[model samples]
Target: MASEDLKTIIENLQKKGKMAFLEKTTPEKIEAFEKENAVTLPEKYKAWLLYSDGGELFLPAGVQFYGIEHKPLLNVNCEDRPSDDYVVIGALASGDPILFKKNSEEVAIYNLEGGKIEEDEKYSDFDAFLIDLPSGILGIGE
Candidate 1:
Protein backbone atom coordinates (compact mmCIF):
# COMPACT_ATOMS: atom_id res chain seq x y z
CA MET A 1 0.00 0.00 0.00
CA ALA A 2 1.03 3.61 -0.49
CA SER A 3 2.44 5.52 2.46
CA GLU A 4 -0.64 7.67 2.84
CA ASP A 5 -2.95 4.68 2.76
CA LEU A 6 -0.86 2.90 5.33
CA LYS A 7 -0.95 5.97 7.54
CA THR A 8 -4.71 5.89 7.48
CA ILE A 9 -4.82 2.22 8.36
CA ILE A 10 -2.44 2.78 11.25
CA GLU A 11 -4.44 5.74 12.45
CA ASN A 12 -7.63 3.78 12.34
CA LEU A 13 -6.03 0.95 14.24
CA GLN A 14 -4.94 3.44 16.90
CA LYS A 15 -8.47 4.81 17.11
CA LYS A 16 -9.73 1.30 17.79
CA GLY A 17 -7.15 0.88 20.56
CA LYS A 18 -5.49 -1.96 18.70
CA MET A 19 -2.25 -0.14 17.87
CA ALA A 20 0.28 2.10 19.56
CA PHE A 21 3.08 4.50 18.57
CA LEU A 22 2.81 6.04 15.12
CA GLU A 23 5.66 8.18 13.77
CA LYS A 24 6.24 9.75 10.36
CA THR A 25 9.34 9.07 8.28
CA THR A 26 10.59 10.38 4.95
CA PRO A 27 12.16 8.30 2.19
CA GLU A 28 15.28 10.44 2.41
CA LYS A 29 15.57 9.74 6.11
CA ILE A 30 15.09 6.04 5.46
CA GLU A 31 17.95 6.10 2.99
CA ALA A 32 20.07 8.00 5.48
CA PHE A 33 19.29 5.42 8.14
CA GLU A 34 20.37 2.56 5.90
CA LYS A 35 23.55 4.44 5.00
CA GLU A 36 24.37 5.17 8.62
CA ASN A 37 23.87 1.53 9.64
CA ALA A 38 25.43 0.08 6.49
CA VAL A 39 22.61 -2.44 6.24
CA THR A 40 19.46 -2.79 4.23
CA LEU A 41 16.21 -3.02 6.18
CA PRO A 42 13.93 -6.01 5.90
CA GLU A 43 10.87 -5.89 3.64
CA LYS A 44 8.45 -5.96 6.57
CA TYR A 45 10.32 -3.06 8.16
CA LYS A 46 10.40 -1.19 4.86
CA ALA A 47 6.67 -1.66 4.64
CA TRP A 48 6.49 -0.11 8.07
CA LEU A 49 8.48 2.87 6.84
CA LEU A 50 6.18 3.22 3.87
CA TYR A 51 3.46 3.63 6.46
CA SER A 52 5.23 5.96 8.90
CA ASP A 53 8.63 7.48 9.56
CA GLY A 54 10.05 7.61 13.12
CA GLY A 55 8.38 8.11 16.47
CA GLU A 56 5.79 5.71 17.80
CA LEU A 57 4.51 3.21 15.25
CA PHE A 58 1.63 2.05 17.44
CA LEU A 59 1.12 3.65 20.86
CA PRO A 60 -0.17 7.19 21.45
CA ALA A 61 -0.55 7.77 25.16
CA GLY A 62 3.09 7.25 26.20
CA VAL A 63 4.63 8.88 23.14
CA GLN A 64 6.75 11.99 23.56
CA PHE A 65 9.03 14.11 21.35
CA TYR A 66 12.69 14.49 22.20
CA GLY A 67 13.37 17.33 19.79
CA ILE A 68 11.92 19.50 17.06
CA GLU A 69 12.22 16.62 14.62
CA HIS A 70 10.22 14.41 17.04
CA LYS A 71 12.66 11.54 16.69
CA PRO A 72 12.36 8.83 19.30
CA LEU A 73 15.45 7.99 21.29
CA LEU A 74 17.03 4.64 20.31
CA ASN A 75 19.88 3.38 22.45
CA VAL A 76 22.19 0.51 21.41
CA ASN A 77 25.36 -0.39 23.25
CA CYS A 78 27.67 -3.20 22.17
CA GLU A 79 30.21 -4.54 24.54
CA ASP A 80 33.05 -5.41 22.12
CA ARG A 81 32.63 -3.93 18.66
CA PRO A 82 29.93 -2.28 16.64
CA SER A 83 28.58 -4.76 14.16
CA ASP A 84 27.99 -3.81 10.52
CA ASP A 85 24.36 -4.96 10.54
CA TYR A 86 22.98 -2.98 13.44
CA VAL A 87 19.86 -0.87 12.84
CA VAL A 88 17.63 0.72 15.43
CA ILE A 89 14.11 1.92 14.77
CA GLY A 90 11.02 2.96 16.70
CA ALA A 91 8.37 0.29 17.15
CA LEU A 92 4.76 -0.10 18.30
CA ALA A 93 3.85 -1.76 21.56
CA SER A 94 1.98 -0.72 24.67
CA GLY A 95 3.71 2.55 23.89
CA ASP A 96 6.20 4.03 21.43
CA PRO A 97 9.42 2.09 21.96
CA ILE A 98 12.77 1.79 20.19
CA LEU A 99 13.64 -1.48 18.42
CA PHE A 100 17.21 -2.51 17.61
CA LYS A 101 19.34 -5.35 16.28
CA LYS A 102 22.74 -6.23 14.76
CA ASN A 103 22.22 -6.30 11.00
CA SER A 104 21.00 -9.85 10.20
CA GLU A 105 22.44 -11.23 13.36
CA GLU A 106 20.27 -12.41 16.23
CA VAL A 107 19.87 -10.33 19.40
CA ALA A 108 18.79 -11.26 22.88
CA ILE A 109 16.03 -9.24 24.54
CA TYR A 110 16.97 -7.26 27.62
CA ASN A 111 14.28 -5.39 29.55
CA LEU A 112 15.76 -2.30 31.19
CA GLU A 113 12.54 -1.09 32.78
CA GLY A 114 13.46 -2.28 36.26
CA GLY A 115 16.86 -0.57 36.29
CA LYS A 116 18.39 -3.81 34.97
CA ILE A 117 18.49 -5.86 31.79
CA GLU A 118 16.17 -8.85 31.61
CA GLU A 119 16.80 -11.45 28.95
CA ASP A 120 14.29 -13.45 26.93
CA GLU A 121 15.83 -16.61 25.50
CA LYS A 122 13.09 -17.23 22.94
CA TYR A 123 13.88 -14.16 20.82
CA SER A 124 17.01 -13.63 18.75
CA ASP A 125 18.46 -11.22 16.11
CA PHE A 126 17.25 -7.80 14.92
CA ASP A 127 14.19 -9.13 13.18
CA ALA A 128 13.26 -11.16 16.19
CA PHE A 129 13.71 -8.14 18.37
CA LEU A 130 11.25 -6.18 16.26
CA ILE A 131 8.77 -9.01 16.30
CA ASP A 132 8.88 -9.17 20.05
CA LEU A 133 8.61 -5.43 20.70
CA PRO A 134 5.00 -5.71 21.87
CA SER A 135 6.18 -7.98 24.65
CA GLY A 136 8.61 -5.34 26.02
CA ILE A 137 11.84 -7.13 25.08
CA LEU A 138 14.87 -4.88 24.74
CA GLY A 139 18.03 -6.83 23.88
CA ILE A 140 20.60 -9.24 25.25
CA GLY A 141 21.49 -8.68 28.85
CA GLU A 142 24.99 -8.08 30.15
Candidate 2:
Protein backbone atom coordinates (compact mmCIF):
# COMPACT_ATOMS: atom_id res chain seq x y z
CA MET A 1 0.00 0.00 0.00
CA ALA A 2 1.03 3.59 -0.42
CA SER A 3 2.14 5.98 2.31
CA GLU A 4 -1.26 7.67 2.22
CA ASP A 5 -2.93 4.39 3.04
CA LEU A 6 -0.52 3.85 5.89
CA LYS A 7 -1.46 7.28 7.21
CA THR A 8 -5.11 6.36 7.04
CA ILE A 9 -4.45 3.22 9.01
CA ILE A 10 -2.59 5.15 11.67
CA GLU A 11 -5.30 7.76 11.77
CA ASN A 12 -8.04 5.22 12.19
CA LEU A 13 -6.09 3.55 14.94
CA GLN A 14 -5.56 6.89 16.58
CA LYS A 15 -9.30 7.65 16.49
CA LYS A 16 -9.87 4.38 18.27
CA GLY A 17 -7.29 5.36 20.89
CA LYS A 18 -5.19 2.32 20.11
CA MET A 19 -1.95 3.89 19.00
CA ALA A 20 0.91 5.69 20.73
CA PHE A 21 3.33 7.83 18.73
CA LEU A 22 6.37 9.99 19.25
CA GLU A 23 6.93 13.53 18.10
CA LYS A 24 7.65 14.01 14.43
CA THR A 25 11.30 14.56 13.54
CA THR A 26 12.95 16.77 10.97
CA PRO A 27 14.66 15.78 7.68
CA GLU A 28 17.89 17.31 8.90
CA LYS A 29 17.85 15.08 11.95
CA ILE A 30 17.11 12.05 9.84
CA GLU A 31 19.95 12.87 7.48
CA ALA A 32 22.33 13.39 10.36
CA PHE A 33 21.26 10.02 11.74
CA GLU A 34 22.05 8.36 8.41
CA LYS A 35 25.50 9.94 8.33
CA GLU A 36 26.29 8.99 11.90
CA ASN A 37 25.02 5.44 11.50
CA ALA A 38 26.61 4.99 8.08
CA VAL A 39 23.36 3.68 6.65
CA THR A 40 20.78 5.08 4.28
CA LEU A 41 17.14 4.65 5.28
CA PRO A 42 14.51 3.77 2.72
CA GLU A 43 12.57 6.76 1.39
CA LYS A 44 9.18 5.43 2.46
CA TYR A 45 10.44 4.54 5.92
CA LYS A 46 11.83 8.04 6.19
CA ALA A 47 8.41 9.36 5.29
CA TRP A 48 6.88 7.40 8.14
CA LEU A 49 9.52 8.67 10.54
CA LEU A 50 8.65 12.19 9.48
CA TYR A 51 5.05 11.39 10.45
CA SER A 52 5.99 10.04 13.85
CA ASP A 53 9.55 9.39 14.94
CA GLY A 54 8.52 6.14 16.60
CA GLY A 55 5.36 4.53 17.95
CA GLU A 56 3.56 1.50 19.28
CA LEU A 57 0.66 -0.35 17.70
CA PHE A 58 -1.53 -1.90 20.35
CA LEU A 59 -4.02 -3.75 18.25
CA PRO A 60 -3.74 -7.03 16.29
CA ALA A 61 -0.33 -7.20 17.97
CA GLY A 62 2.21 -5.03 19.70
CA VAL A 63 4.87 -3.66 17.38
CA GLN A 64 7.60 -1.15 18.15
CA PHE A 65 8.46 1.01 15.16
CA TYR A 66 11.89 2.41 16.00
CA GLY A 67 12.95 5.97 15.28
CA ILE A 68 16.14 7.63 14.04
CA GLU A 69 17.24 9.16 17.30
CA HIS A 70 19.61 8.72 20.24
CA LYS A 71 16.83 8.62 22.81
CA PRO A 72 16.51 5.09 24.17
CA LEU A 73 12.77 5.18 23.59
CA LEU A 74 13.17 6.05 19.92
CA ASN A 75 16.58 4.64 18.97
CA VAL A 76 16.93 2.03 16.24
CA ASN A 77 20.61 1.21 16.66
CA CYS A 78 20.20 -2.34 17.81
CA GLU A 79 23.73 -3.42 18.71
CA ASP A 80 22.80 -7.10 19.10
CA ARG A 81 21.55 -7.32 15.54
CA PRO A 82 22.69 -10.11 13.28
CA SER A 83 24.91 -8.00 11.02
CA ASP A 84 25.87 -4.58 9.77
CA ASP A 85 23.94 -5.17 6.56
CA TYR A 86 20.66 -5.15 8.47
CA VAL A 87 19.12 -2.59 10.82
CA VAL A 88 16.23 -3.31 13.17
CA ILE A 89 13.49 -0.83 12.41
CA GLY A 90 10.87 -2.51 14.56
CA ALA A 91 10.26 -5.62 16.58
CA LEU A 92 7.53 -8.13 17.34
CA ALA A 93 6.16 -8.82 20.78
CA SER A 94 8.06 -12.08 20.69
CA GLY A 95 11.29 -10.04 20.55
CA ASP A 96 11.99 -11.00 16.94
CA PRO A 97 13.50 -8.10 15.00
CA ILE A 98 11.89 -6.59 11.96
CA LEU A 99 14.92 -5.64 9.89
CA PHE A 100 15.64 -3.60 6.80
CA LYS A 101 18.72 -3.81 4.66
CA LYS A 102 21.08 -0.86 4.98
CA ASN A 103 20.54 1.67 2.19
CA SER A 104 17.75 -0.51 0.75
CA GLU A 105 13.99 -0.90 1.13
CA GLU A 106 14.00 -4.69 1.45
CA VAL A 107 12.59 -5.87 4.79
CA ALA A 108 12.71 -9.18 6.64
CA ILE A 109 12.18 -10.97 9.90
CA TYR A 110 15.31 -12.56 11.31
CA ASN A 111 14.56 -15.39 13.70
CA LEU A 112 16.80 -17.44 15.87
CA GLU A 113 16.37 -21.04 14.91
CA GLY A 114 18.66 -23.95 15.70
CA GLY A 115 21.14 -21.54 17.22
CA LYS A 116 21.50 -19.59 13.98
CA ILE A 117 19.99 -16.45 12.57
CA GLU A 118 17.66 -17.19 9.65
CA GLU A 119 15.37 -15.16 7.46
CA ASP A 120 11.99 -16.32 8.70
CA GLU A 121 10.18 -14.11 6.22
CA LYS A 122 10.90 -11.44 3.63
CA TYR A 123 9.10 -8.61 1.86
CA SER A 124 9.95 -7.06 -1.48
CA ASP A 125 9.88 -3.58 0.04
CA PHE A 126 8.99 -1.58 3.11
CA ASP A 127 5.52 -0.68 1.89
CA ALA A 128 4.53 -4.25 1.21
CA PHE A 129 5.82 -5.23 4.62
CA LEU A 130 3.82 -2.52 6.36
CA ILE A 131 0.72 -3.45 4.37
CA ASP A 132 0.85 -6.99 5.58
CA LEU A 133 1.91 -6.18 9.14
CA PRO A 134 -1.51 -6.64 10.71
CA SER A 135 -2.30 -9.81 8.81
CA GLY A 136 1.12 -11.20 9.60
CA ILE A 137 0.57 -10.49 13.26
CA LEU A 138 -2.85 -12.15 13.16
CA GLY A 139 -1.33 -15.31 11.67
CA ILE A 140 -3.42 -14.81 8.54
CA GLY A 141 -0.62 -14.59 5.99
CA GLU A 142 2.62 -16.29 5.00
Candidate 3:
Protein backbone atom coordinates (compact mmCIF):
# COMPACT_ATOMS: atom_id res chain seq x y z
CA MET A 1 0.00 0.00 0.00
CA ALA A 2 1.03 3.58 -0.52
CA SER A 3 2.35 5.47 2.47
CA GLU A 4 -0.75 7.65 2.68
CA ASP A 5 -3.07 4.65 2.44
CA LEU A 6 -1.16 2.90 5.17
CA LYS A 7 -1.53 5.97 7.34
CA THR A 8 -5.26 6.02 6.68
CA ILE A 9 -5.62 2.36 7.51
CA ILE A 10 -3.70 2.93 10.70
CA GLU A 11 -6.04 5.77 11.57
CA ASN A 12 -9.12 3.69 10.88
CA LEU A 13 -7.74 0.87 12.94
CA GLN A 14 -7.19 3.24 15.84
CA LYS A 15 -10.80 4.37 15.54
CA LYS A 16 -11.80 0.77 15.95
CA GLY A 17 -9.63 0.49 19.06
CA LYS A 18 -6.31 -0.59 17.66
CA MET A 19 -3.15 1.01 19.00
CA ALA A 20 -0.97 2.41 16.28
CA PHE A 21 2.03 4.71 15.94
CA LEU A 22 3.93 6.23 13.03
CA GLU A 23 7.54 7.44 12.69
CA LYS A 24 9.31 9.15 9.86
CA THR A 25 12.92 8.15 9.11
CA THR A 26 15.30 10.38 7.28
CA PRO A 27 17.58 9.06 4.56
CA GLU A 28 20.63 9.74 6.70
CA LYS A 29 19.12 7.90 9.63
CA ILE A 30 18.17 4.94 7.48
CA GLU A 31 21.67 4.76 6.12
CA ALA A 32 23.12 4.97 9.60
CA PHE A 33 20.83 2.24 10.89
CA GLU A 34 21.84 -0.03 8.05
CA LYS A 35 25.46 0.70 8.63
CA GLU A 36 25.19 0.06 12.33
CA ASN A 37 23.37 -3.19 11.75
CA ALA A 38 25.61 -4.20 8.86
CA VAL A 39 22.60 -5.51 6.93
CA THR A 40 20.03 -4.10 4.60
CA LEU A 41 16.41 -4.05 5.64
CA PRO A 42 13.86 -5.89 3.60
CA GLU A 43 11.87 -3.86 1.12
CA LYS A 44 8.66 -3.92 3.13
CA TYR A 45 10.49 -2.94 6.30
CA LYS A 46 12.30 -0.22 4.42
CA ALA A 47 8.97 1.14 3.32
CA TRP A 48 7.80 1.11 6.89
CA LEU A 49 10.87 3.07 7.94
CA LEU A 50 10.44 5.60 5.17
CA TYR A 51 6.78 6.05 6.05
CA SER A 52 7.71 7.10 9.56
CA ASP A 53 10.50 7.40 12.05
CA GLY A 54 11.02 5.00 14.93
CA GLY A 55 8.05 5.05 17.27
CA GLU A 56 4.99 3.08 18.24
CA LEU A 57 3.21 2.69 14.89
CA PHE A 58 0.12 1.10 16.31
CA LEU A 59 -0.59 0.97 20.00
CA PRO A 60 -3.45 2.50 21.99
CA ALA A 61 -1.05 4.01 24.50
CA GLY A 62 0.22 6.36 21.83
CA VAL A 63 3.54 6.31 20.05
CA GLN A 64 6.63 6.75 22.13
CA PHE A 65 9.53 8.69 20.75
CA TYR A 66 12.72 7.07 19.52
CA GLY A 67 14.64 5.05 22.13
CA ILE A 68 11.40 3.99 23.78
CA GLU A 69 11.98 0.28 23.10
CA HIS A 70 11.56 0.66 19.36
CA LYS A 71 14.33 -1.57 18.12
CA PRO A 72 14.51 -2.44 14.44
CA LEU A 73 15.39 -6.09 13.73
CA LEU A 74 16.68 -5.43 10.27
CA ASN A 75 20.26 -5.60 11.45
CA VAL A 76 19.98 -7.94 14.40
CA ASN A 77 21.05 -11.33 13.13
CA CYS A 78 19.49 -14.52 14.42
CA GLU A 79 20.63 -18.07 14.80
CA ASP A 80 20.08 -20.33 11.81
CA ARG A 81 16.58 -21.67 11.58
CA PRO A 82 14.83 -24.05 9.24
CA SER A 83 12.83 -21.33 7.58
CA ASP A 84 15.05 -18.78 5.92
CA ASP A 85 11.98 -16.74 5.09
CA TYR A 86 11.08 -16.12 8.72
CA VAL A 87 11.65 -12.79 10.47
CA VAL A 88 10.83 -12.95 14.14
CA ILE A 89 9.88 -9.44 15.25
CA GLY A 90 9.37 -9.63 18.98
CA ALA A 91 7.19 -10.70 21.90
CA LEU A 92 3.64 -9.59 22.60
CA ALA A 93 0.78 -9.95 25.06
CA SER A 94 -0.18 -13.31 26.69
CA GLY A 95 3.24 -14.77 26.05
CA ASP A 96 2.25 -15.05 22.40
CA PRO A 97 4.67 -13.54 19.89
CA ILE A 98 4.60 -11.79 16.52
CA LEU A 99 6.66 -12.51 13.41
CA PHE A 100 6.87 -11.71 9.72
CA LYS A 101 7.65 -14.09 6.88
CA LYS A 102 9.37 -12.99 3.72
CA ASN A 103 7.42 -15.28 1.44
CA SER A 104 3.81 -14.43 0.70
CA GLU A 105 2.65 -17.64 2.26
CA GLU A 106 1.62 -17.54 5.89
CA VAL A 107 2.07 -15.65 9.13
CA ALA A 108 3.51 -17.77 11.94
CA ILE A 109 2.43 -17.12 15.48
CA TYR A 110 4.47 -18.67 18.23
CA ASN A 111 3.96 -18.98 21.94
CA LEU A 112 7.61 -18.67 22.74
CA GLU A 113 6.94 -18.48 26.43
CA GLY A 114 4.98 -21.71 26.09
CA GLY A 115 7.70 -23.22 23.90
CA LYS A 116 5.82 -23.93 20.68
CA ILE A 117 4.95 -22.61 17.29
CA GLU A 118 1.26 -22.24 17.88
CA GLU A 119 -0.17 -21.51 14.42
CA ASP A 120 0.68 -21.29 10.76
CA GLU A 121 -1.88 -20.10 8.29
CA LYS A 122 -2.22 -18.03 5.16
CA TYR A 123 -3.94 -14.67 5.42
CA SER A 124 -3.13 -12.70 2.26
CA ASP A 125 -0.51 -12.15 -0.38
CA PHE A 126 0.93 -9.22 1.48
CA ASP A 127 4.56 -9.27 2.60
CA ALA A 128 3.98 -8.13 6.18
CA PHE A 129 2.09 -9.63 9.09
CA LEU A 130 -0.83 -7.57 10.32
CA ILE A 131 -1.36 -8.36 13.97
CA ASP A 132 -4.77 -7.91 15.52
CA LEU A 133 -3.64 -4.53 16.74
CA PRO A 134 -6.52 -3.69 19.11
CA SER A 135 -6.22 -6.86 21.14
CA GLY A 136 -2.43 -6.97 20.98
CA ILE A 137 -3.04 -10.55 19.92
CA LEU A 138 -2.27 -12.59 16.89
CA GLY A 139 -5.13 -14.76 15.65
CA ILE A 140 -2.92 -17.42 14.09
CA GLY A 141 -1.24 -18.49 17.26
CA GLU A 142 -2.78 -20.73 19.88
Candidate 4:
Protein backbone atom coordinates (compact mmCIF):
# COMPACT_ATOMS: atom_id res chain seq x y z
CA MET A 1 0.00 0.00 0.00
CA ALA A 2 1.09 3.53 -0.63
CA SER A 3 0.81 6.80 1.26
CA GLU A 4 -2.11 7.87 -0.93
CA ASP A 5 -3.98 4.75 0.11
CA LEU A 6 -3.41 5.56 3.75
CA LYS A 7 -4.70 9.06 3.15
CA THR A 8 -7.79 7.68 1.49
CA ILE A 9 -8.48 5.44 4.43
CA ILE A 10 -8.25 8.34 6.84
CA GLU A 11 -10.40 10.47 4.63
CA ASN A 12 -13.06 7.78 4.46
CA LEU A 13 -12.93 7.34 8.20
CA GLN A 14 -13.35 11.05 8.65
CA LYS A 15 -16.26 11.14 6.19
CA LYS A 16 -17.90 8.43 8.23
CA GLY A 17 -17.25 10.39 11.40
CA LYS A 18 -15.43 7.46 12.95
CA MET A 19 -11.90 8.76 13.25
CA ALA A 20 -10.49 9.83 16.61
CA PHE A 21 -7.16 11.50 17.32
CA LEU A 22 -5.45 13.01 20.32
CA GLU A 23 -4.24 16.57 20.39
CA LYS A 24 -1.17 17.25 18.31
CA THR A 25 2.15 17.30 20.14
CA THR A 26 4.75 20.04 19.96
CA PRO A 27 8.07 19.80 18.18
CA GLU A 28 9.77 20.73 21.45
CA LYS A 29 8.25 17.67 23.17
CA ILE A 30 9.25 15.52 20.25
CA GLU A 31 12.74 16.92 20.48
CA ALA A 32 12.78 16.20 24.18
CA PHE A 33 11.81 12.59 23.53
CA GLU A 34 14.55 12.29 20.96
CA LYS A 35 17.19 13.82 23.23
CA GLU A 36 16.22 11.70 26.19
CA ASN A 37 16.14 8.51 24.14
CA ALA A 38 19.24 9.35 22.14
CA VAL A 39 17.43 8.47 18.95
CA THR A 40 15.87 10.52 16.17
CA LEU A 41 12.38 9.62 15.01
CA PRO A 42 11.75 8.89 11.38
CA GLU A 43 10.40 11.80 9.35
CA LYS A 44 6.97 10.30 8.68
CA TYR A 45 6.42 9.28 12.29
CA LYS A 46 7.50 12.71 13.40
CA ALA A 47 4.93 14.21 11.06
CA TRP A 48 2.30 12.02 12.63
CA LEU A 49 3.20 13.22 16.10
CA LEU A 50 2.73 16.77 14.92
CA TYR A 51 -0.57 15.99 13.22
CA SER A 52 -2.55 13.83 15.61
CA ASP A 53 -0.09 12.81 18.28
CA GLY A 54 -1.86 9.40 18.42
CA GLY A 55 -5.26 7.86 18.86
CA GLU A 56 -7.70 5.14 17.90
CA LEU A 57 -7.96 5.12 14.13
CA PHE A 58 -11.00 3.00 13.23
CA LEU A 59 -12.99 3.09 16.45
CA PRO A 60 -13.82 -0.11 18.39
CA ALA A 61 -10.83 -2.46 18.23
CA GLY A 62 -8.92 0.12 16.19
CA VAL A 63 -5.17 0.52 16.38
CA GLN A 64 -4.42 2.83 19.26
CA PHE A 65 -1.18 4.58 18.48
CA TYR A 66 0.61 6.19 21.44
CA GLY A 67 0.80 9.92 22.13
CA ILE A 68 3.73 12.00 23.35
CA GLU A 69 1.98 13.74 26.25
CA HIS A 70 -0.65 11.13 27.04
CA LYS A 71 -0.40 7.36 26.63
CA PRO A 72 3.32 7.67 26.06
CA LEU A 73 5.32 4.92 24.36
CA LEU A 74 5.69 1.63 26.20
CA ASN A 75 9.39 2.13 26.84
CA VAL A 76 9.01 5.53 28.45
CA ASN A 77 10.58 5.46 31.92
CA CYS A 78 10.90 1.70 31.76
CA GLU A 79 14.00 -0.41 32.34
CA ASP A 80 12.68 -3.53 30.62
CA ARG A 81 12.18 -2.34 27.08
CA PRO A 82 11.26 -4.83 24.39
CA SER A 83 14.52 -4.07 22.63
CA ASP A 84 17.22 -1.51 23.18
CA ASP A 85 17.42 -0.87 19.45
CA TYR A 86 13.68 -0.31 19.08
CA VAL A 87 11.17 2.25 20.27
CA VAL A 88 7.71 1.02 21.15
CA ILE A 89 4.99 3.00 19.38
CA GLY A 90 2.03 1.10 20.67
CA ALA A 91 0.69 -2.34 21.56
CA LEU A 92 -1.70 -4.75 19.97
CA ALA A 93 -4.85 -5.62 21.90
CA SER A 94 -3.05 -8.68 23.23
CA GLY A 95 -0.21 -6.46 24.52
CA ASP A 96 2.41 -7.35 21.95
CA PRO A 97 4.46 -4.26 21.23
CA ILE A 98 4.46 -2.44 17.90
CA LEU A 99 8.05 -1.36 17.59
CA PHE A 100 9.83 1.11 15.37
CA LYS A 101 13.58 0.80 14.97
CA LYS A 102 15.46 3.69 16.47
CA ASN A 103 16.85 6.11 13.87
CA SER A 104 15.32 3.99 11.10
CA GLU A 105 12.01 3.50 9.36
CA GLU A 106 11.77 -0.23 10.08
CA VAL A 107 8.71 -1.31 12.03
CA ALA A 108 7.60 -4.67 13.37
CA ILE A 109 5.65 -6.41 16.05
CA TYR A 110 7.50 -7.56 19.17
CA ASN A 111 6.49 -11.00 20.35
CA LEU A 112 6.47 -11.13 24.11
CA GLU A 113 7.19 -14.84 24.41
CA GLY A 114 9.98 -14.76 21.91
CA GLY A 115 11.14 -11.36 23.15
CA LYS A 116 12.06 -10.41 19.60
CA ILE A 117 10.65 -9.15 16.37
CA GLU A 118 8.49 -11.44 14.28
CA GLU A 119 10.67 -10.85 11.25
CA ASP A 120 8.03 -11.70 8.67
CA GLU A 121 5.80 -8.99 10.10
CA LYS A 122 8.20 -6.15 9.56
CA TYR A 123 7.28 -3.06 7.49
CA SER A 124 9.66 -0.80 5.64
CA ASP A 125 8.41 2.31 7.37
CA PHE A 126 5.68 3.86 9.51
CA ASP A 127 3.50 4.69 6.51
CA ALA A 128 3.73 1.17 5.17
CA PHE A 129 2.61 -0.28 8.47
CA LEU A 130 -0.30 2.14 8.60
CA ILE A 131 -1.22 1.42 5.01
CA ASP A 132 -1.67 -2.19 5.99
CA LEU A 133 -3.34 -1.46 9.31
CA PRO A 134 -7.06 -1.46 8.51
CA SER A 135 -6.99 -4.70 6.62
CA GLY A 136 -4.45 -6.24 8.94
CA ILE A 137 -6.59 -5.64 11.97
CA LEU A 138 -10.19 -5.98 10.78
CA GLY A 139 -10.28 -7.08 7.18
CA ILE A 140 -11.50 -3.64 6.17
CA GLY A 141 -10.13 -3.74 2.66
CA GLU A 142 -11.04 -7.33 2.13
Q: List clash counts for every candidate, in order.
A: 17, 0, 13, 0
Residue-level lDDT of model 1, residues 64-113, one tens digit each, is 21211245433333222223233334322333223334444444322334
C-alpha local distance difference test of each model:
0.41, 0.70, 0.45, 0.70
Candidate 2 lDDT by residue in tens digits, 61-130: 6677888662334345676467777888887777787778776788877774432355447777766776
Error of 3 at 119 (Å): 4.7
Give the alpha carbon lDDT tens digit for every residue of 1-142 in model 4. Answer: 1245456656755654366787888889989988886778877777777777877766666566787776755355443246577777876666677778777898787778777776667999877777666666445764
RMSD of each: 7.7, 3.8, 5.8, 3.7
Model 3, position 8: C-alpha lDDT score: 64
Ranking by TM-score: 4, 2, 3, 1
- Hey, what RMSD does candidate 3 come out at? 5.8
Q: lDDT score of model 4? A: 0.70
Per-residue alpha-carbon lDDT of candidate 3 for residues 1-142, written as tens digits (9 for 90 to 100): 3476566655655565444445456667767765775544445445555664444433434222222125543324443222455544443444343444554344445555555555543333223344344443332222
Number of the candidate with higher TM-score, 2 or 3:
2
In angstroms, how far off is 75's CA in candidate 2?
A: 5.6
TM-score to true structure, per model: 0.44, 0.77, 0.53, 0.78
Q: After superposition, how far is residue 9 of candidate 4 from its true place, in Å?
A: 5.0
Give the top-scoring candidate (lDDT). 4
Give me the overall lDDT of model 3: 0.45
